[model samples]
Target: MSAVASVVSLVELLRGNPGSCRWTGGLSPVDLARAERELGTPLPPSYRCFLAEVGSCEVDGTDFLGVYRTPAMGDTLLGTVSGTLDARTDPRFPPDLLLIQYDGMGGLVCLDLSRRDRAGEAPVVVWDPGSADRGGPERLAADFGSYALRQCTQALTRGG
Candidate 1:
């Protein structure tokens, strides 16, 4: 499937099975632009589409970070833009990594911006902060579309 189609499928799954997933609705172009400005970079096209189709969401209580629909709805530690800003304060955090989720294991799921493709897609990777043996971020997917597909499949497999 194409990137946009993959994201559309993911959004449909998230919306169709409300028992296992909850979504915060999509963002406006203005909000997306604001988020990009705040983050000081252009978001990947597939990821931007996902955020515009499903701003923020959780599957079985595991939140996928994105721009919140409104300022009042944002959590400093969970909203994509805000969370990334806060994480940037850490000297150890790489400047090109954009936080997308907490791995529940002292690891960060992020978009590796430094490895962005010519099409503007970044690979999803997991960085284990507490693992001395993990020399660098472990790639999770080729792009946000693939990552979203994996998340949707996992949620469905869990009886969503």
Candidate 2:
């Protein structure tokens, strides 16, 4: 599937109401714009379409955090969770694109990068969405789509 189609499918899966699963809050348009501005970059085209169509939060009618796609330098796009505006107060992960926060979950929501189908396992790296690191941006951009697919699958399996 195309990256955009994959994202849409992921969003639909998240919107599924499976028992305890619920629709949580999503980022407001203003908030999204502010985040993009803070990061000093435009979000990915596919991601923009996802947000515009499916929105930034789940549709199950609960208050779970949602995913937003950041700019793609090459293949990967930085991913960020909704409701985390303060990076200092929040334990922002190094590989920020892979970082996620679900409802009622605390601390950094870390996803196993190795479990992803396309990328090889290395140490979990916390990404800084606001600032691109030396060589890190390229890595993230390259692997972001696959990483996102893995994350959505994991979340669905785990009932997150």
Candidate 3:
């Protein structure tokens, strides 16, 4: 499925279990534009679509970092993308790495904007602060959507 389709399905699943799913919120096209403008860079197309569709949400307690939808724009809590990049102490961190999600710990999932994979999308990689010196990121997905598919599916079906 396309990235937007994938997100739609996930959101649908969340809707079915609102009592358990945690939705931080979602973002509008304007919000996406502002975030890109503020960061001085554009986010990947797939991720932008996801934000437009899924925003911020948690699946079975697994929160996928997303833009804040309500009390909405200009909120500092919605600054996950740039915040983590600023706080990173990794000297070898790439110049175009965009922090996309937090693993609820000290680690993050980032998109490599500087380099695109065979599919023309930036590769998603994991940054574990404790292992920053390991010389490279642990590649998570070919793109943000792929990461979502791999992770969200696992998260939803783990015990089903």
Candidate 4:
């Protein structure tokens, strides 16, 4: 199956199952485009398809966290809390990359997704898989999905 198809199927499964965290729609197309322009890179294909077909939704697992898609622009807004892990020590973390794109063809691309936080002292690294350097998009997607699921489970149990 195509990457986009796989993601859509996954969404369907999540939508049908109450055990998994639910997703609420996210940023609008204008916002997604703005983000893309600001970032100077296109979003991943699976993410694009996700935005188009699934749109965005608040995940039931994690309060207020979600993956949003923009059908018009074919972009995705991954709204989740940022987690930090020192790549040097964390074996599970991938290398630092601004954005990672996975085409479901066993191909992964990493883009620089660093931006200055509100404090502006240091840049915030969104996804860093434990490698000494940045890893592929598939890796980031997998890691983020895993983290989201774990957080969702916790949130559901806490009734958050």
Candidate 5:
């Protein structure tokens, strides 16, 4: 199956039976395009599809970041992807690393924009804050689709 198709299917499955994942509908195309322009790079296919077809979600209790403000959710806006990525709140965090989501237990899930894997997409990695300056980030998946599906599997195991 195509990457987008597979990612969409996974989202469907997770939405149907997500344990603690807070899933939501996809974002509008216009908003996603704006985000891409602001980020200065085209998003990977899986993430692009997810944002355009699945919006924000909290899979396995971890809140995934979204790109635009949703009207349904008022002033308490979580934030757009660009905002989170550009924040660089911590000096230890690499500038090329984009924070996607943070697991409740203090580990952050992020994508490396500096290099793209053979599949022409940035790889996702888990950054541990506890060992902040000691070691390198651990690889999560080759791409966002793989990462999301893995998380969905965990959700099913826990909630299904």
Candidate 6:
């Protein structure tokens, strides 16, 4: 199966169990453009597909950040836009990285925007705030699609 299809199918399965996932809905092209404009760089192709297909979501208590909604309406709006902006305030956080998830252990899962493959996909990496200098962020996946596939598969495996 194609990467996008696999990710979408897995997410759908994960969402079948009520309360297992909370999705913010798919994002419009306009919304994507706005996010890209604000971020000052185009997001990776796989990530763009994810935002368009699933937007932001919390699956089995794990957040997979995406484009934020306007007038949030109490939706928390703690997705990619907000998370990246918030992290950028820290001197230690690199200015070009995009935050994708908070690993719940003082570590953040982010896209290494500076490093992209020929397919325009960025590496997914885990940055531990408690130990930034301890060998730097650990790479989690080659791209968002792989990372998300692993997450969805794990969530389903755990019976979520």
Put down candidate 4 lDDT per residue, 46-145, tens digits, no spaces. 4444444444443443333223444753543443211111122445443334332332343323332343223221221233242335452233223223
Residue range 32-55, candidate 1, lDDT tens digits: 888888888999988899899998
**Top-lDDT structure, candidate number:** 1
Q: What root-mean-square deviation over C-alphas does model 3 reach? A: 3.1
lDDT of 2 at 92: 34
Candidate 3 local lDDT, 1-160, one digit each (tens)? 7554565676677777765567655677778888888666877777776777767777765667776633545465364554645745566556577787776766767887777755446788877655557877777777877677667667777635
Evaluate residue 26 in candidate 6 and report its C-alpha lDDT on the 0 to 100 scale: 78
RMSD of each: 2.5, 10.2, 3.1, 12.1, 3.2, 2.6
What ranges in model 6 sit over 4 Å off? 1-5, 11-19, 70-78, 130-132
| Runs off by more than 4 Å, candidate 2 | 18-20, 25-30, 50-145, 158-160
Estimate the overall C-alpha local distance difference test score of candidate 2: 0.43
Q: Which parts of model 3 have CA positions greater than 4 angstroms off?
A: 69-74, 77-79, 88-92, 117-120, 129-133
In terms of TM-score, the best-performing candidate is 1
Measured against the true structure, the TM-scores of the candidates, in listed sequence, are 0.88, 0.43, 0.77, 0.42, 0.77, 0.85
Question: Please, what are the lDDT tens digits per residue for candidate 6 over residues 77-138?
Answer: 44798889889888888776899988888888999998888878888898866546687788
Q: Report the candidate with higher TM-score, 1 versus 6.
A: 1
Off by over 4 Å in 5: 1-5, 18-21, 68-83, 128-132
Q: Report the poorest 10 consecutive residues by lDDT, candidate 1.
A: 69-78
Consecutive 10-residue window with the lowest summed lDDT within model 5: 75-84
Model 6: lowest-lDDT 10 consecutive positions: 69-78
The 0-to-1 C-alpha lDDT of every candidate, in the order given, reads 0.81, 0.43, 0.69, 0.40, 0.69, 0.79
Can you give the lDDT of residue 82 in candidate 5? 49
lDDT of 2 by residue, 1-160 (tens): 6555666676666556445343323456775576566544445544444445544443323232334445444322223533334433444344233333342423333333443333232222334443334544223232333445455566556655
Comparing candidate 4 with candidate 6, which one achieves the higher TM-score? 6
Error of 6 at 150 (Å): 1.0
lDDT of 4: 0.40
Model 3: pairs clashing at backbone N, Cα or C within 3 Å: none
Candidate 1 or 4, higher TM-score? Answer: 1
As for lDDT, the candidate ahead, 1 or 3, is: 1
Error of 6 at 52 (Å): 0.7
